[model samples]
Target: MNTTLQQAFGNIDIYLFDQLLKGRFDSCRNVLDAGCGGGRNLLYFLQNGFEVYGVDLHEQAIQNVQHLAQQLAPQLPPDYFQVAPVEDMPFPDNTFDLVICSAVLHFARDEAHFDAMVRSLWRVLAPGGYLLARLASTIGIEDRVESLGRGRYYLPDGSERYLVDEQTLLSYTQELGGELFEPIKTTNVQNLRCMTTWCAQKL
Candidate 1:
């Protein structure tokens, strides 16, 4: 990704995460940025006063996170970064107050992978913690761009995403214990296409 695209994605993600973050977490405690790319979201969490742990499948993201943390806040060390998959996070169970899996789950190659990813996130989140996740849905404007081969769709990375709908999300919530569902909106498009955000909390 070029600087321009990276900036745009970063801005969009920050906006989305910020909206869901508000009023949900009362304290700046332990949080996990599952699939946190380059540790950027972890930086946001830290800047906002959260003790953050970043995990990603790619070694580069983990390395970038370490370097970024060293440069941005050298005082916060040791318990911060790891290279791991969302489906099988390396940390112990109930490790974080919040688990963030942004723009990553949709890349899962199948439903099992997606379900496992969600379950793993839920397992790590402490009671009252939340999963602030964003994905490419089939119900947003981006789907059109992606269908035409121009948008940021999770395809090349062995990722398979479903253009999820409201009922599907609701059903998933019901199937899993300890969660509430709140979907987020995107920029208005003539037709609702791919891309959506949702926040789920552990009860």
Candidate 2:
């Protein structure tokens, strides 16, 4: 619940935290947090000398990120943070060496919307860049999910989400010509819902 941009990472997705532990970003200097949502995933990047950029559809979130950047990394341009949707970002292609999209894709309205959001993120990812995404999925709890068609599902937690299955993820990874940096893994939260961690490298 701590969304503050402190020197210490607070409330980052566990999958992203694992990548940090594995040094997946050790050599990367330019990082982007798409759907940054209060900059919970950006603390480490700001404090570690990385050129951090973030985008969110919410104006307040963007402002918060800009303030955090100005405070922790004054050298970075104030425009590094912007109010933009993941489906239509303003950055040029191949601009980021690392991109994080946590809990964002599940908000997709439909199939095309999902593809648009993913492609927008992928378009900005530099070759050999790493992409870390954590989103809702029906991977292990397929039987428990109520299908709403076009990738949307009603979860046991009573929320609706655009849930992906293993096959869908693999298909998209192939479509993007990306290689798996880590096998697809899902965590079921006591039948309430399932979240999947997907890590890949652009080939």
Candidate 3:
């Protein structure tokens, strides 16, 4: 059977974390692959020596990973995953050493939902743990204006996104008691239309 685009997206995380953030992996352990579609990222983290756990709202995602694990000869290392939404995670407070909500926050339906997601992520973070979030920050002003909706932005990909600005992100993390890192500018000038990201460390 052919894999889906969602599966390919999960595989892309392996590339992003391994390549984009490879130098910074030293700060993470007991990682949570939040919005972990298909569990490919948990496998990536496991291979990189992190004790990982993954969670997603889709049961199909969990089943996909389970199938992948069952097919592997060498036990896929130590990892656990569950089905749950971002606003309400199943794990206890301060459960993860690193929480990655990559490309997921924009789905929040409203301000309250968005606030809850930030709070939930912070609550499960161990002191000094990091939360890395990437969003649709690369869209142009014309694009944003044309796609405005009920308190959010609609992307052409049929993915509802919240057009978050850099200052807004910094304010949330700072108010929540995190030490925010400087933006990592894209090294390639040609890829200027890249998502803006923030790495906040819980204090």
Candidate 4:
């Protein structure tokens, strides 16, 4: 990665970077990163004057994000970041224009937990808002994973995750009353694990 680019983007997910390139979030002002880990996906937004907030279960992660914000977006108050779970974010209803949950959903203990987190993310999103997520899925490596019951699976990579399939994601999109902002896409890493990008806009 170029030094200049790294300073600007700070390890943003490539798919999310693609969305940035496409101007998918050009009109979005308030952004919330649910389950933010060290604010890896937030550098660009913070630097560009977006009203950015974040929440994480880990206290250390929240502290790290606050430090990152202080360095890049000094105007933002420290309280903008909180230590909270994705399943129960502390924000008011329909507050943010963009909700980002990257590489976090796969840690769900079960289908119910996953649903709870998704609903929380949706609840805080304003009308016509975008929800961007990346999570482990059984899309391309369906045969390479063993079901552990309750939507959990043991992947060939020797890691366990609550993996969703293409149909499941599409069904959820419909259930959430959201339209696909972009076609659902997945990247397979050496057939070890598959990560899917689900970008949807609330109708």
- lDDT for residue 146 in candidate 2, whole number 0-100: 96
Tell me the tens digit of each residue's lDDT in model 1 across 1-203. Answer: 67854443344365445654565565638878888788666655555556778888888888887887776567667457887888898888877887777888767666677778888888888877777887766654434434322222443333445545555566776676655546554433345434566777777
Best by TM-score: 4
Deviation of model 2 at 31, angstroms: 0.5
Candidate 2: 10-residue stretch with minimal lDDT: 1-10
lDDT of each: 0.67, 0.90, 0.66, 0.95
lDDT of 4 by residue, 1-203 (tens): 59999988889999999999999899999999998999999999999999999999999999999999999999999999999999998899999999999999999999999999999999999999999999999999988999999999999999999999999889989998999999999999999999999998999
What TM-score does candidate 1 reach?
A: 0.76
Superior candidate under TM-score, 3 versus 4 = 4
Which segments of candidate 1 are over 4 A away from where they belong? 1-12, 15-17, 140-160, 184-193
Runs of candidate 2 with Cα error greater than 4 angstroms are: 1-6
Clashes of 2: 0
Please give the clash total of every predicted structure, in order.
7, 0, 0, 0
Q: Can you write out model 3's per-residue Cα lDDT over 68-170, one digit (the tens) per residue?
A: 5545423544236678888788878888877887778777777788888889888888887877776655334334333465447654445456656666777
CA error at residue 134 for candidate 3, angstroms: 1.2
For all predicted structures, in order, the TM-scores are 0.76, 0.95, 0.76, 0.98
Ranking by lDDT: 4, 2, 1, 3
Off by over 4 Å in 3: 1-10, 18-22, 69-79, 138-143, 147-150, 155-159, 184-194
lDDT of 2: 0.90
For each of the candidates, the C-alpha root-mean-square deviation to the true structure, in angstroms, is 6.0, 2.5, 5.4, 0.9
